[model samples]
Target chain A: MALDKQFIGREYGPYRYTLGEEKMREFTLAVGGAKPGAGTPGEPPAHVSPLLYDEQAAKAGPHGGLIAFPSFAVVFAIRPFSAAIADPALNINMQMLVHGEQDLEFLDVMRPGDVMTTTGRIADLYERARMGFVIVTSESRNQHGTLVVKGTWSAIIRG
Target chain B: MPRTYQPGDTFTHVRECDRYRPIYYAGASGDYNPIHIDPEAGSAAGLNGNILQGLCTLGWVVEAIAGFVEDPGRVRRVKARFSRPVRPEDTITFQGRVTAVQDGRLTAEVSATNQRGEDVLKGAVVEAFIG
Candidate 1:
């Protein structure tokens, strides 16, 4: 089924998420990266640093909260795609899709305890010669309504 | 405390694009795009070759910073704009510089350049220096 052009510019909900340290560790491990732990005498892990949760160390930054891992925002930004694909109205088969491109802009750093709300919109939808493309843009804001991150995702729907 | 970095402080790491790496990233990221896996599908879509997922390249950048700080937690913020597609067999060199250090925070401009020296990703990363 072809994508409905009218869906373009349509906005989705302001879904909320809470950042957690364990989740970060899980994401890292799932990505084939090492988990943070104390180093041994001769061998140290390639990835994983406890500095993220050290209050004294992170307090050195402009924000006093624990510094988030660089790719932490991916957790929040990816939710909307599943929602869009699951919408019965769209009829998008998840298996027949490919992620074409993605871009993210961090306006500010978010702390571990920060409660963030993300609102997504179908920014663009088009098709070309049996292939379809959908672009979704999601903006995440902290509890104070401060913009934390803006994410753009493009999916290619194969016919 | 204001910290300034000289030109010689820059660091670079080159990575070979392994075909299987994209599948690994796809499983982790939940992005199953055929172009990243199926060569014929990618060619049919007008891609020069089976391209790597954008997040996979971002993951490399994350890996680069993770090596520098020795701890992923020290990174406060990271953002990047994907400018080009990364093809399989292409070697990408991750480059970074300490652009500024203000109020005890370190700001670095980082990028990934292909073997052709074309910029694939460009962005800034902010890290908290415990030292």
Candidate 2:
């Protein structure tokens, strides 16, 4: 089904996501990053340093700040895309989908253990021949509603 | 503790993305999309050739930031948008600047641009510094 341009700018929910350090490490490892000081595929290239642990403590503690993973915002922005694809009127099949493109803007840093709420919207929709493209942009904020990240994702649908 | 930094501080490296370095990212990340590995599939899909996963570029950017801050775990946030595709044999350079330093946090605007000068991904990263 063709995407509706009218949905552009339509906002979705303020979904919440919690940041975790182990998950971030797992994700980095999963993506082939070298571990700190370990010369292995997907591990960080060098030791992360003990100073980071102190910083992490400060950020994760009360009255401290938050530290967010690089691509953590991807989890939040998927909401609007799911809603758009799940719409009965759109009739999109989950199996044939492809992630065409993605864009993210970090306005502020989030610490591990920080509570974040994400609000999303359909930013753009268009079609080329047999393919339809839908773009969803989401903004993530802390509990105080302070903006942390703005993410824009594009999915290409082909029939 | 106080930390000192200069504006022109930069580090650069080049690695070959070849057969041995195979696109192992697909299975590890569940992003087993054909365009990253199957050259024929990529060509059939209208791509100039087999393309590197966008996340790989992100991983490189993360590595650059980790180097700059000297601590991978201190990276609090990374925000980027994929602007173009990085095909096999495409050498990418990650360039960044220390745009801001305030209240012990260093903010840098970084990007991955290809040999063609086209931006493959661009974003800002914020890291907490402990000195």
Candidate 3:
């Protein structure tokens, strides 16, 4: 089914997510981040390692707590948008969908316990000879109403 | 802790894709697409097997940039094109180069290749704000 271009400006939600330390750690480990001073990847060393993986750095990190990794916002931002596109009104085919491109802009830090609200919009819709494209842009804001991050997720649905 | 980035300096980050990477990321990121979690589902989709999420691969590159700048928030902007599928057991390497520094922002061009030497992230760019 061809994606409806009329849905381009449709918005999804402002779902809330409270950041968690354990989630940050799990994401760090799953991505194969090389913990400082550990040959096989483990705990973070004080003087080195990315702030997202280091407890000490987290203490001194941006927002003064456990900071989520650059890509960690995905955990908080993708679900609502998924629901938006799956609306029977849109009639999107799920079986042949594949991610094609992604873009992210981090404007503020997201620390553990911070409440983030994520909202999404269908930014654009188009078609190639054998495929349909849907671009969704999401914005995440902290409890204080400060924009924390923005992401553009583009999926190419094979025809 | 702030780290200075200079133009022309290069760094490399290599990671082995855990056999269960797809499942792990699927749970963490809430992308439960069968193409990334079930091998049989992948075959039906014409892939070699359960393929890892492209964003998961991009995560490594973001981590590398965060490591370079010493803070994840310092990474201002990032974008990537999913050129190829990454299957289980792929050894992905991120090769980053400081292409330019302008107005307190450092830009890096990244090339991520798999065990087979294919450029999985053929066109990727990362911009970090240092000022």
Which candidate number has the best TM-score?
3
B82-115: candidate 2 lDDT, tens digit per residue: 6677776677787777777778777777767778
Q: What is the TM-score of each candidate against the true structure?
A: 0.63, 0.61, 0.89
Show model 2 residue runs off by greater than 4 Å: A1-3, A11-23, A32-44, A47-68, A75-79, A82-119, A126-133, A140-149, A154-159, B6-8, B13-23, B72-83, B88-90, B99-111, B114-119, B122-131
B18-99, model 3: which lDDT tens digit per residue? 7777887776677889999999999888886789988899888887787777667788888999989998889998999999
Task: Supply candidate 1's per-residue lDDT for A48.
Answer: 41
Structure candidate 3, residue pairs in collision: none
What is the C-alpha lDDT profile of model 2 across A1-159, one tens digit per residue? 477777778777878777665544444544333333334334343333222233555455432643434554554545665676666656666445556665555555555676888777778888998888878777778877788777667777767
Ranking the candidates on lDDT from highest down gives 3, 1, 2
Estimate, for each residue in B1-131, the C-alpha lDDT of model 1 and write its tens digit: 53344433565656777666566556545666777877887777777557787776776676676556555544555556667778878889888887776675566778789999999875545343533
Candidate 1 stretches with Cα past 4 Å from truth are A28-32, A35-50, A53-56, A59-65, B5-11, B14-53, B62-92, B96-131
Top-lDDT candidate index: 3
lDDT value, residue A90 of candidate 3: 74
